[model samples]
Target: MTQAASSAADRRALLRLARQRLRARVRRPNAGDAITLALPAVLVAGALWSGSAASVPELATRGDAAALGMLLAAAVAFLSYGMLFRAADDPFLRRLGVESRAVYAERAARLLAAGLALVVVLAAYAARAGRIPDQLLPIALVAVLTAWGSGAAATTLAGRAMVTRSPGSGWGCLTVGMWDREVAAAAPLVYAPLIPLLSGGAAGAAAFGTGWPGVGVSLAVALVLARLGARWWEAAIPRFGPQLLEMAFAPPPPAGVGELSVGRGLARLLPRAAAAVWARDGVVTARRFAWATRIVWPVAIVTLALLARRGTDPGTRGWVALAALSVWMLQMVALVGLGRYERGGRRWLDRSLGITPLQRVLGRWAFGWGASLWLGVPLALAWGWWTDAGPGWPWVFVGAGTAAVGAIASVTAAGWR
Candidate 1:
């Protein structure tokens, strides 16, 4: 075939693959599945709306638009993580029987299109909120540009991480989370919408007053990082396919730990049976620690650092700090609860071993909480010191205690389900 014809054929194949994937994703879920996916969002939104009357005063007094912008950026970063890093698995690439920079260039083009769509939506919202045409246009343009840059930077960070760490490693999940959090904390304004909301001004003022040059610098950095990531990705692609296949085909590694006399040693501190159960659960918790620990603390620390450096209104600062602490605690609990469900299949075995449901639940809770404490102690100390809260020991105790109770409650609820 001629070069032009060959290229046309390849484009057709890619378009067809894209269509298939879209159809697969759009297939309707069952009623129950749809409800399961959506009920939490509904409930949370409903609760917020219901409480808005009561919350208005507090919210007005302590709201931080900048902080909210950072959170939105973090959410987008998470949403795009898979898109940015794992194009090797693209069905179109397999069909093409080719691996080249052109594939990624195509992917980047698609992302740009999507980013433009997002910019358009955001511009409409700004206009509706009374932004003049001049402000709206510049804001839209900046939002798209900044998003492109942020996404490229995220991709580069993931690629660099892939080069340094195996995804299957124990800390791999944590490392990825920390990177996301750090990026969000560091470049919160990249999302652009946050600027006007916080500034309560036209786009030009927000853009310049909040240091718009940073956005251009980020774009420059992203260009350099993209080059580096592409080089690393090219080297890594050859090994990627086999590694995935091996993982898919491999059997589960056996329950890899021996029964412990350690449980007996701790029996004096707890019920003998509970201690034994806790020890076994401890092994599992150690092996499959939650990704949340990696995420929450790093994000919280970075946020605190930002607050200290930027110096928000004291009321806003305190509220933000408390909110961060709450998030960290809630995340720890949710992770523990999820882990219990993950091991639900083993409940029968515990029953067979004469362990009551309550004991099994508590044991898992204990292990989760204990592991969280080990992680939280250092964080609490850091937070306390950062806050200049005298007698930081109270913060340490509060952190550990809150984590323990929350985790226990989560595990118990999961068991009941």
Candidate 2:
């Protein structure tokens, strides 16, 4: 084949591969996953509708902001949830009829396509609602493109970092570590939704217009980074072998001792009896980098609340609902990680120490609730100060506290099982 023909053939092959993979994914989704994926859209729509008390321009602005948030959340979910690749499939595909590079190419292409789709969906939604002014349309497209490209690049790097630094552990331990990294990386992207605030307002379209060159530069840099990541993976796979690949994608086993650790700290900060547990939890959290997520999660919620305040009319019930939901989601993540640590790493020690089940449960609650309040109390106070709901900030904090307790109660109860 001529060089041009060969390149054309390769393009065709990659497109074919990507299509087949996408079709396979479509077939695999059942009701549960489908419903879960749709939840964000529903929540966004509901929030927008509830805030209809605002003026048309205000509603439009809020809708646009929410759309931006939804896109960021989707990107974060893509990066953090699972193994970066089906690395195990390389040998099988090679034996059958595929090069490993093609796999990476297909994955990258799919990710890029998803980013483009986000742009299209947001544009269509805005156009349909007529919320975004015509003059701002081009700027909106540029902004979304910039965010998507930069986000994709960040995710690729994060995945590469995790895989490169991944230690040799059993399937279960490795999987847990991967999960931890996902949560940590995703916590930062929470701020991405607030990128729109930088534009200021409809009047600020000129601001974004001036930044167009920067956006283009970011997109180019992202493409280069993504390519580098794929190249790195393509080179790494051959040495990994089928066994290691299998272990990488394998279902995680029950959580265990590897999930917990004791770092340098006071095991005597609390009651003499519970000091060890408290110290271990504190040290493990501080040293392991997991504590960062606790801070990030709350910060993200507060950012969202502030954004809502800007987008919606004061005293809108939707704003409160949105804040409450953010807290619930943050607490859910904390509970899951904390629960796993307790069950896998600390349970045996607790039993031996004659730590009553109540004490154990309370300890876990204390750990999670404190983490929640670190950001939650200030978030509640801010929501009150910013929104028409200021007078009811007391009630808002009460509700926030209640939700935190509920999350802990649920997680602790699950540990009881």
Candidate 3:
């Protein structure tokens, strides 16, 4: 075979292998798991859709369409970045004599396919609504392409950052230490369009224009970024491939001083049995990078609230604050299962330790509530204060209520397990 043909075959083979691995990992969901996961997601999506439908008339304008497109792009980019890192098997592929470029190509193809599927779904929805302008359709398509390319490049850079021990400062160091280098690297990409969308100026309008010229420029930029990402992947693989593999397979490190201190503080605040469970859950969550990264959802909600205050009404701003707190609560509740179910032999070990079902349930609930309160209070207050709302005292009560709901829901779900 010619070199080009040989390369094509390699990519095809990699794609097939990736699909097989995905299928192998994804077990058929039980009814309880289906309801637990699907119900909340469906409700949230329905609420968001209703709100969006109410504003469909406003989407006729170029600025509104641009803003919406940017927001969609940001969402796709962030999800793609997270998914890439979470499921990366680059080192393993490298060991199989598959080139890094091939791996990157396969991943990029999958991301683009997913982004295009989203575009199709949104396009169909907009068509049914009959409010979206014809000109904005291309803009939406370009936005997805841009997002996919940006996400791929960001993920590559983030992977590179993870294996590097270079000293960093500020939030970069802090987030990287938490195994959130993907978030740190992708933050700028995620926020670039958001800033303009929130600020709503002439420049912002021009940058996110829904014209064909803008779409063409965006497509070109996306292609360039994808090219750069491929080059970066090829370069980094030779240098950092082994380190990435090692990090992927390495055992979780022991809990740090911060975790221990948090546990000690919770111990003093709670009953002995519950505190032990709370402390154990905290440590377990901290040690698992994937679980730790779920904190991003709440943080993203808060960030949206902060940005949304510029043109939003007081009532809307209040709701945004409430949503931020509520999401934090829900995020914690979702994590309860991750702590108990993901690790092998964990349930057996818990039973061996003489931890009763009641204690386990109470501890999980307390941990979820406490963690929600710890993160949500400050975020809600900040959102309220920044939005010129009162000290956000009302949101604290709202958060507490939601946290209780989440805690109860978590315990009930655990019971089903």
Per-residue accuracy of model 3 over 1-417 as CA lDDT, tens digit each: 765576678899988987786565446544334445566567646644654444443555657655766665755665665455444565566667765677668777887777676666666556556556565556666667667666677667655655454555434433443445545643443343333233222222444444677667766877787788887767766766676456546364645543544347646776676778777776665555343436646565555555455524666665565556546645555654544353344655667778776776667667666666655566655655566555656655665565455555554444433
- Model 2 agreement with the true structure over 182-298: per-residue lDDT tens digits: 444333233332332332222123324344464465456546755665666565545543534544343443456334443224333445444445445444544443443444554
TM values, all candidates: 0.48, 0.47, 0.68
lDDT of 3: 0.59
Q: What would the per-residue lDDT of candidate 1 be over residues 3-36, giving only the tens digit for each residue?
A: 5566556656555676676565448643332333
Clash count for candidate 2 is 1
lDDT of 3 at 362: 68
- Candidate RMSDs in Å, in order, are 9.7, 10.8, 6.3
What value of lDDT does candidate 2 attain over all alpha carbons? 0.48
Clashes of 1: 0
Q: Which stretches of candidate 3 lie over 4 Å from their true place?
A: 1-6, 18-27, 30-52, 60-62, 127-130, 157-217, 245-256, 259-272, 287-337, 354-361, 378-417
Instruction: Give the worst 10-residue stretch by lDDT in candidate 2.
Output: 195-204
TM-score of 2: 0.47
The C-alpha lDDT values of all candidates are 0.47, 0.48, 0.59
Best by TM-score: 3
